[model samples]
Target: MDEIFHVAQTRLYCRGIYNEWNPMITTPPGLYFLAVLFGFCGYERYLNSLILPFCFAGLCRLRRFILISTKGKLKKEIDQFRDVRLSALAICFLPVLLNNSFLYYTDLLSLTAFIWGISFNSSLISSIFLALAVLTRQTNIVWPALNCLAISLNLLKQFLFNQISFKQLFFKTFKFIYQFLLVFAFMCFLVWNNGSIVLGDKTAHKPAIHLPQLFYFVGFTAASSMPLFISYFFQNYKKIFNRFSLISMLFISLFAFLSVNCCTLAHPYLLADNRHFTFYLWQRFFQRHWIAKYLAIPFYTFSAIFMFKMTSEIPNKLKAFYLVFTSLCLIPAFLLEFRYFIIPFALWRLSLDYQSRKAQFFEILINLMVSSFVLYLFLNRPFKWPSDPERWQRFMW
Candidate 1:
């Protein structure tokens, strides 16, 4: 369904009809612009496949940036070169990300732009990528804005603590603001677009304060990176369980129950679309029984707590900014789509301080298996819709 609009728009661009627009397509035209650069390509899917290399390049750059950022804290056992390469490969094959890579969707290109924006050291170049990111997807504006805020907050703390002179702080802040101008540009675009983030599909993509999205996102990170979570659990199981008293456990349960009971939202698209895996997940688990939603609370709690524990090794400044940015990104969306969780999950997965070789190997193996499974289902398991019997509907993430 989404491919219909994206592929058509790119074809129009290929024909030199740059003015054409699709009202059903909610994202900006950056993806189409990038697709046009391939000179119409061998096929639309092939053109989309070209974006994967750029994505991998950006991921490698991001891994290098992470290694440099955590160099002092890195374990002596960590093999920097091999670990970086494998980690980038593992992330490139993440189920949701890899599934979207072959489609004419904004997800891969948007993520690539965002990753380069974060990884690049040059302010002008970084801002260019960041602006391109927002041009690909309007919601991406929040990330650069959050990045700017994080830098400012960190600098302010350093200045306050007398660790950095006011002169140095002023120069650093200026450099950050200059590099992350995407946020400012995006705000200007929003005003020009009549205060709407999405260019089309305004009715369907309505903004709401759906708080349960945070829970769903956390659960997704936990599930997607289960190998690391399991490793963390075994290494710190005693410390983890010790933090949870009976009363704390009860409080967590009550909080999860209320969140599920009061904050859960069923979007119209989520209910109507069976071609996407989220629909089945909703129908099978969240809607299967009255207590099914409540049952998910424990998993959510476990994810949130353990994820926090895993990130405890990051610097205080970065950790605070990461949490703030993640919450702001996920808290407003009213949908349960897994694609929305991809960027935040990628950042979380990359920034972890303890990704041993064993964890990386398991991560790659599991992601490969899941990616192959989903690809098989998408290709071979086609079902016909009664309303459109001529069209084959395949399952996807």
Candidate 2:
């Protein structure tokens, strides 16, 4: 308890103007204010540090309510509370509760920023949180960028495809550009105020560029681009693909890949151990190891085959072509690495919404269950049970 108190106190004092050089204890100014309030009680300091951001995120949602009310747009049928609760549950509870609650990490902040951005549609607030997320941990950079790109693409779609009138397209483009400028300006302000951009202590000494890191980054890019290539090939061969759908798939695939990669790469210890390859392998195997993972491939292949079972929806010729393409492209890929194949499979499944909800639900359930089971087995057992016997026993107990 005393040690915890000392640590909290040290963090508080380190935030003082007099201790500007201490990089280890630095936190965002927003978090620092909360730290000052609860610093006397160490645990409270940490708790409050976590709670305040969540509170601010709540306030951000509330601001949206206030906006709607002021505009006299709040309707009885709106059920603002239900909407808020659902959003909170999905954005906050789903990821944090299932994945990494109590971690006090940037992921929470990233999610909050994401939710806040969606809630208010205020680029400034969203960009501020995103910038803080990156400053707190560089891994968070991808999500914000991806989100912005998603919004940007959606706007582009509206301007180019949806809007029939030139005037309407011009107006929408201007609105998007204005919002984007606000976000960009906010980010610039944050970077300027933060003095030195430090990812972490490990990165503080080294220059940003490294050759091996670049190579791995290139590999990740290639992996992400694979879906685009597949989509394009299908389109060229008079298959099911179209430009809009292809772009959307590429965006999502690249976004997910980048988000996962950035989060993984920011840790020096992970980089040191070449955990990238291990993570790649895990994803390749759908989070399983050698034999079990290999066995799962046949099941996955069967599932992919089932995807084509909805052939009644497609023209016979196109269906035949798609089946042949699926066999040649998806089967070989699934056999080699089911995890990598799963993304494309999912994209294709989602594309088939006109098929049937029941079918989609079953496909999704199977994918989730298989993937989760494999992950559980990998994380729990790996090569040997009780890799750390003490930790394993404690976990069980």
Q: Write the per-residue lDDT of candidate 2 for residues 1-397, one digit (tens) a residue.
A: 0123334534655457424433443234333333455563344335435653573456436434543543446444333443333323322322112222232333344344433443455555656555554443333343444445656676677767755466765665554454455446546745874633332242333323221232222233223223333333344444434565456455544544443344222334323222123434445553454343334333333232334432224445544543343333322211121122222232232223122223323333443454455445435753423444443210100
Worst-scoring 10-residue span by lDDT in model 2: 331-340
Clashing pairs in 1: none
User: Tens-digit lDDT track for model 1 on 157-229?
Assistant: 9999999999999888878776555677777888998898878768888888787787899888888889889
Residue 45 local lDDT, model 1: 71
CA displacement after TM-score superposition, residue 232 of candidate 2 (Å): 31
For each candidate, give its TM-score against the true structure. Answer: 0.89, 0.38
Candidate 1 at residue 66, lDDT?
Answer: 77
- Which lDDT value does model 2 have at 146? 45
